[model samples]
Structures are given as structure tokens and as C-alpha cells.
Target: MARILIVDDAKFMRMTLTNILTKANHVVVGEGENGKEAIRLFRELDPDIVTMDITMPEMSGLDAVKEIRNEFSDAKIIMCSAMGQQKMVVEAIEAGAKDFIVKPFDENRVIDAINRVLG
Candidate 1:
């Protein structure tokens, strides 16, 4: 099972993802509320993957992706975006995210993304 870090502004989102990941037998290493925390958690936790929310207070997920990729070229990240945030999702991928899952998250889709990225 892959170790994961979840970063989202919404507590409910984080809990949802945690439930999904845990039920899939993945370990959640940490949770963060924004991009800045995402970066710091990545450094400290060194999880197998990260799920990052596209928009947050301190920094955008796009920026976090860029920063993390800059520091750790192989860091695996997945962007989480709400419906109609397609442009931001694309930008996140360009910034170095491996893949993305749209919200509100679908269980199969989320698992598929994690498996795909891990592979």
C-alpha cells in the first residue's frame, strides 16, 4: 500500500479522501490545509503520493506542484479540482502533477488514479 499525504482547505474533503484511501489499504501519512503545508509535509513525510487541492489560501496547488517538482523531481502528486476547474487542472498537470481527480470524488475514480500514478 502506498503512503499518501492529503492537502485540502476543506476538512471534510481530507476526511473523505482519508476514508477512501484507508479502505483501499493505503496509509495516510499526513494532511494539510494549503499548498505551503503541502510542501512542508512532503519534505517531512516523504509519502509515496500526494493529493493536492487546486485552490487554497496560502498557495495554489499548481504552485505547490511546481515547487515540489523543483525540489523532488520524482514526487508523485495528484490534483483535486472542483467541476469546471478544468483549466486549473490542466495547469496543475503542466506544473508536474501525475494525474487529477474531480470533486466531489468518485470512489472508483480516486482509486484508479492512485493506482495509475503509483504504477
Candidate 2:
């Protein structure tokens, strides 16, 4: 189990992710609605992993990835993307996300991605 931070613009997505992580026995350290809060929470929570949506207000997930990676090189980020956001996914990876899970999440994929990144 890992300390996790879930970030997404939609409350439903956040709730869904939280449920999945909690069920797997991971500690959900925090939740955030935008990249600004993502960054702020990262510093405060220091979670072992973060699941970040690629799009959000105030700041984009890509920018947040870069900012967090800049400060914490060991930060492990998993990008959450919707279909047809392949371009943003690449940018997120280039910006320092460790892995990705497509939207309309699959429990297996979500858990697998988290495990892969944590490992």
C-alpha cells in the first residue's frame, strides 16, 4: 500500500479513484480539484504516489508534473487521461508522469498502474 493523492476536476472521478485505492488498502492522503491544489497538496501530504488528471483549471496537469518533478525528483505521478487525449498523455510523460490510466477507469488497470509506478 502507498500514500496516494487523487486529483481530478470531476468529483465523481476523484471519488471513484479514492474508492479503488482505499479498497486496495492504500492510504489516501489528500484530494485536489486542480493543478494548483495538486501542487499544494503534494508538498503538504508528500504522498508516495499521485493520480493526476491531464486537464484542470488554474493549471494543467502537465505543468503540475513539471513543477513537482522540479522540486521532488523522486515524485511518482500517474496521469489519468480520457480517450483522444493521447497528445496530452505524451506531454505528461515528458513532463515527468511515471505512468497513465485511461478515463472510465478499469479497476485492474488502475491498480496495475499504481503497482507499476510504486515498484
TM-score winner among the candidates? Answer: 1
What TM-score would each prediction reach against the true structure?
Answer: 0.99, 0.98
- Candidate 1 regions with alpha-carbon error over 4 angstroms: none
Across 1-119, the per-residue lDDT of candidate 2 in tens digits comes to: 89999999999999999999999999999999999999999999999999999999999898999999999999999999999999999989988899999989999999999999989
User: Which residue runs of candidate 2 sit more than 4 Å off their true CA positions?
Assistant: none
In model 1, the worst 10-residue window by lDDT is 87-96
Tens digit of lDDT per residue, candidate 1, span 1-119?
A: 99999999999999999999999999999999999999999999999999999999989888999999999999999999999999999888888999999999999999999999999
- Whole-model Cα lDDT of every candidate shown, in order: 0.97, 0.95
Error of 1 at 84 (Å): 0.7
Candidate 2: lDDT of 55? 91
Kindly report which residue pairs in candidate 1 clash with one another: none
**In model 1, how large is the Cα lDDT of residue 11?**
100
